[model samples]
Target: MKRQVKPIREGNSEPGTVSLFSIAGIKTLLQFLRLGKKSGALLSMAVATAIYTWFYQWEFALGVTVMVLVHELGHVAAARQKGIPVTAPFFIPFLGALIMMKRNPRDAATEAYIAMGGPLVGTIGAFVSFLIGLFTGHSLFYAIAYIGFTLNLINLLPIHPLDGGRIASSVTRWLWVAGAAGGLFAVIFLKSFLFFVLWALFVWDLFSKYIVHRGKAAEYSCWGKIEVPFDQIPGENWMLIPFSEREPLPYRTYSDMDGKQWVDINWEEADVVHPVKMQEQGLIRSVFSTKVERRWQQTPKVVVLRYQIDYEPHEIENYYEVPEKVRWRFGISYGALAIALFVLLDLVQLMMNEQGGFFHSLRK
Candidate 1:
């Protein structure tokens, strides 16, 4: 009983290895778990799942939660692929899931792609559900598929904060008026508090866009054709052009008395103001003066104090530079919109036949 036990060999026995449940191992495990943990996303999903489970059943709730997660993850994936920093998908009890991006897309195409990815992946998930229902003849699968289809389809409506609205906005700011109308229709016809929220969101978006556009217009007005007297032009032919919120840049002026064009000039440092040079080059034609004219005669023509410019020109309109990606985005957006409409109609008809309407089925 008093004999000493042999020491355990480190390499030959399991006791030498770290135990996952041991104190040190546990601390390491905790650190690993904390790394890249998306606590907010997990919490939101848990709360949403709990709400859905309470309203319906565990299976239905799980299915819906998975679908929304898949949809939002689609956006996250696309953004990441484009080198955009994005957050994990966060779920809302009834509103669905969303991903917070760190910054805006560089162009319309990037925005459209990011918006479309969610619906594209969500639609695939719905189709898979539909197939499962068809094969198994399970009504639960059908219900899940219906929810997926309708939710994604609704997101495609031309309303602000929706995928379709973002896509349309890239084409023209004027299209927001149409989006506002759609929001109004949702509020009036659906009579749902969700639509009311959407309408309010659209109104806020319009106001924000107006403020942004006004600021842009003011900035644009500062850089344009400025008619200065001939006397003001530097002898070295260097003119200082004023720009709003930016440093003045060197400009070259040409005068044409016959054409009555005093504002004929070109920007010497076009890159300083406009990177694309879309609206700056060819903005003014060449004009020159061969001689200076005497304006007054005093005490045998000794006075040389008056100079004048005959004409003033208005500011030339600024041109918007379309990125190369716009064409591709335009094509993809329309195609996606068409598909969304078709899916929406199909879901509506199916829901009507099954439960009188989409909302009615949801209630059931």
Candidate 2:
């Protein structure tokens, strides 16, 4: 007798089935337009964003939107070049656009290029602005470029998830997960609410990428094992790994020869142990206390490949898929500084003893 082909069934609903998009029709439409998957929680985020945008529509805030959009588009453009299906940029008023990446990127190189694409665009934009500034003597042009490029540079840090971060991960797997965890904690301690939330969002993703869907036979070296707090750590039984109900709580342990003695480790092992969250959302000190949560509610889904990595028997609360090297290349750009520069220029405009009636006639 011939056997019929078996069907593959995932336990939960597919991507975009989350309950974060249960708001009203218009809000729902906007959320869907920006985000790919549907979730009830996203609806709440939409409501919140709409309310916040109502109060703050200042030019500076709008300019920040432009900076973020350009940064996101850099990734989008790279994705398009790589033949990845990407949604149009979703304009979120004072916030910014969130690209809806339909599928996981195929490899590290692809991810890196996509991640760098945004910063690259910003760098070019900044260069153009700098050129414009050189010609017109209008410092604001340079300031805009600075704002555009600086954020990209920050994203390029090899800490984890950032474009530069992926580069670091590709070099050493242990450092990659450790870097991600450290970056998350650092952002929280720093009081960067925006990045703090983004980091929190990755807690579960990290577990998924490192533990649940670990690459087994790949030629690349990765974190072989992670130890957590006695209670938080998974059981010693390796077969019991991959409990997805909760994200894996990964910790560190070092073993001596013959695998007898084991010692617990800490953030010191991580290549980059961030005190709080990342520096996104404009909050530098993005450390989240045990009480508060992250600010950026609408976290974009992280893209990652699968089946090649080995599996671990545990759970990760919030995991994220990221690239390597490109995240750490700070020398590549400096547009964020433009924000500060623009502030100073505004001051200069205030104090300049101009002969013509330009600032007084229009800008003022």
Candidate 3:
């Protein structure tokens, strides 16, 4: 005997059947995941916000997160302006947010320009917050403004990996000495063990770049002369070869185990007809010529090419080619920004104190 199954209800589907709404929801989720893959900024930012909210009040957490986002966007804008490729900002809960460069800046000036952008724009963001607090008389906005000013001010310390360190490359290396002293003071004042660790790292960087690698700095400077020997020339007719007739030479640039960079040209694979023509054209000659070997001068800050031709080594001091006028401009800007942040920090403190202190106002 066969048993009869219960009749399905009009509004209910079979057990195994999925609703149209579910399918649509799943498609939406998949699209969001794909977007996260392309740019993790939003997702990571959400995660950071969640973690910060867990530790502190949501208002403070959100404010700090937005401030950091503004700072990173400044860097992104500057990089774009300089035609440098960079990834979107990724946030770390306690640490901060950062953007990675796809390629290094070619010179100290470019690096400084990009570096200064973050603190410069970040200061503006904080100042805006300060104004909002003044208008609204809200302690929360004032508190955020104070924190923002402090963060940007700390970043102005001339230490490696810090914005000020890169800016100092175009200004003056002597600022690093000041950074060492300032970093120590920051560690003590803030009472942050993390900052102490950073200070230690900064000290080591100073020693490595300035003391240990002092001689090498001048020796491996960027700029070199390339020459093609007349003996290596295949024929006089090679020079007559049209530029379009010659195939492009393939080459790859990479860093060695010691972090020294090198450019390897595949001369064997290149069209032999192009070398002499490239030599006659000057600058294009190095990569096309079989007789040239290329080495890159690698430093903590910049990488520059050094070429060897026919066993002769030549060097050119073009790395720090930023004009004196530009250097003065960067110096003045850096100093003015720092002073402005300090003044804003004091103003925020005064306002908060009038409101019965930041903590008291927040509690109310």
Q: Specify the highest-lDDT model's number.
A: 3
What is the Cα-based lDDT of residue 302 in candidate 3? 20
**lDDT, model 2, position 231:** 30
Q: Per-residue error at 208 for model 1, in Å? A: 5.4
Ranking by lDDT: 3, 1, 2
Q: Over the stretch 150-170, how does candidate 3's per-residue lDDT look in tens digits?
A: 889988889878899889989
lDDT, each prediction: 0.58, 0.45, 0.69
For candidate 2, report its TM-score. Answer: 0.43
**Candidate 2 error regions (>4 Å):** 1-59, 91-96, 170-190, 200-364
The sequence of per-residue lDDT tens digits that candidate 2 reaches over residues 124-182 is: 66566556656787645544555555565556545545666654443345555665667
The predicted structure with the larger lDDT, 1 or 2, is 1
Instruction: Identify the candidate with maximal TM-score.
Output: 3
TM-score preference between candidates 1 and 2, better one: 1
**Candidate closer to the true structure by TM-score (higher is better), 2 or 3:** 3
Please provide, for model 1 over 95-119, each residue's C-alpha lDDT reduced to its tens digit, 9 standing for 90 to 100: 9988866655556667767887888
Residue 331 of model 3, lDDT score: 97
